[model samples]
Target: MLEIKDLHAYYGKSHVLQGVNFEVGEGEIVSLLGRNGVGRSTTCKAIMGLVAPHGSVRFQGEDLGRLKSHQVARKGIGYVPEDRLIFSGLTTRENLQMGIQKMGAEALWTLDDAYRLFPRLQERADVKAEMLSGGEQQMLTMCRTLMGNPKLIMIDEPTEGLAPQIVTQVGDFLLEIAAKGISILLVEQRLSIAMRVSHRVYVMGHGQIVFEGTPADLEANEAVRKEWLEV
Candidate 1:
């Protein structure tokens, strides 16, 4: 559903993403896997129009490079950054309410669906977002983005630095998302989750995709793993 070709991004002359290329098929989970600073996050930002893209970003046959970030989102792409961006002052339910593109608009995701995915959100529905724990904040962020009812969701490091149990929960959540016919472009470093949940994986290095294969292909190729993935 999303295709990026020859994508490049710069931070005032510092080239971050260099001719990155990939595609996320409809209802498929594609993981962008690499270590820190290899430009995975920049790929998402460039696609989302947060960064000025120097190449083609096409979604559902529409060119997205000329669009602004909000415009890109309105095109049905949801982005959940690594940093959990939430309204600290708003109640959990209120924050979720803000993600609705339009009240009672027909969409695949809803507040009820979000609550079913993470029941803890319902338990803390009345609490301020700032008062939640780290994992809770992460869940809230993902759910709030879901409230937008995106056709595709690009999540950056959804399981970063959380407890193992929570990490597992996040993995299950990803599976559930894919089951709902939503394409997912997941930027994840955790190999187990990526391998388990992703239909295909791309290994990036020095701001370009160096490897692309199924989870089994990745597991069998120790050389590629050691070169681009293993730390």
Candidate 2:
């Protein structure tokens, strides 16, 4: 459902994405993997039109490169930033309400659906977001994004800084979302999480995609892993 070609982006002359190219099919979970500072986050920003990019981004055949961030969002792309930036002072219910797009009620995700996916959110409806644990915060973040009813969700580092049990929960949640036909573009530092959840993987290094394959393919190819991912 998403295609990026010859994508080039920069942060004030420091080139970040150099001719990066990839695609995510409808209902597919694709992982964009790499070590720190390899342009994984920049790729997400460029797709959302948060950065100026000299390339083509086609989402469901619409030219995305020319659209603004809000415009792109309106076209059914939701972004959950890496930081899980929940409003600390707001109640969990209130924080989720912020993700409700201006669009009408016909949108795919509803408050009921979000609560169904995350029962904890429903239980803590009146609790302040800041009082939640790290895992709860991440669940709140994901549920908040789902409230937008996006066709494709770009999740950056959803498992970062969470306990292993929470990581597993997040992975299961992603799988559930995918089963409901939501295409996911996942950026993750944890290779195991990505491998378990992603149908395909794209490895980036030095601001470009150097490898693209299935999880097993990536595992067998030690050279690429060692060069691009190994610490």
Candidate 3:
């Protein structure tokens, strides 16, 4: 239920996202794929309002362009940046607790739910976040955002720098998220996981969408992969 139209963003004089357009339907997993320096991350930042946007970003029919990042989160959108912004000093459990958006409001996700998704989090419940391994930290970051019970979550490069086994866990987690009816706008570099989990994929190039299709459709288009996705 997220729609971005004619989106554009700049870093001083440099234009990062130019006339970008896409939408994420309810409970759908949409992946934004491209090689490095192609504005994939910038698109996420612009939609989250961390970057100044020059076009329309609408969520469930409401304009998000003018809103602040926290404001956007409150409007049922959660963002997990590529950096995995976890609280280094907080305990694993405490870091998860920090993601609680509503005290008593009914949420689709809970602490126990998060623990069940990844038992390692429960095992190290009392450990500080900084002490966790890279994969564990990534899992923590994602589960923390889910605590907000977002209608749509935009995760930027969820599998980056993790071990292959951890990457598979992340993929399973994405499927579980979609099974629970949460929409996902996944910005990923790893095509295997993205292709496996995404209902549709969008390939970006030079700050624009170059290809939009189902996973099967994308798999059949070798040229698109060679030009925009493959290194």
Estimate, for each residue in 23-131, the C-alpha lDDT of model 2 and write its tens digit. 9999999999999999999999999999987899999999999889999999999999998899999999999899987456566777777788778889998999999
Find the 10 residues in a row with the least total lDDT in model 3. 100-109
**Alpha-carbon RMSD to native, per candidate:** 0.9, 1.5, 0.8
Off by over 4 Å in 3: 103-105
Best-performing candidate as measured by lDDT: 3
Q: Which clashing pairs does model 2 show?
A: none
Residue-pair clashes per candidate:
0, 0, 0
- How many residue pairs in model 2 have overlapping backbones? 0
Error of 2 at 199 (Å): 0.8
Candidate 1 error regions (>4 Å):
103-105
lDDT per residue (tens digit) for residues 146-228 in model 3 = 99999999999999999999999999999999999999999999999999999999999999999999999999999999988
Which of the predicted structures, 1 or 3, would earn the higher lDDT when compared with the native?
A: 3
Q: In angstroms, give how far residue 156 of model 3 lies from its true place.
A: 0.6
Worst 10 residues of 1 by lDDT: 101-110
TM-score to true structure, per model: 0.98, 0.95, 0.98
After superposing all C-alphas onto the true structure, candidate 2 shows an RMSD in angstroms of 1.5
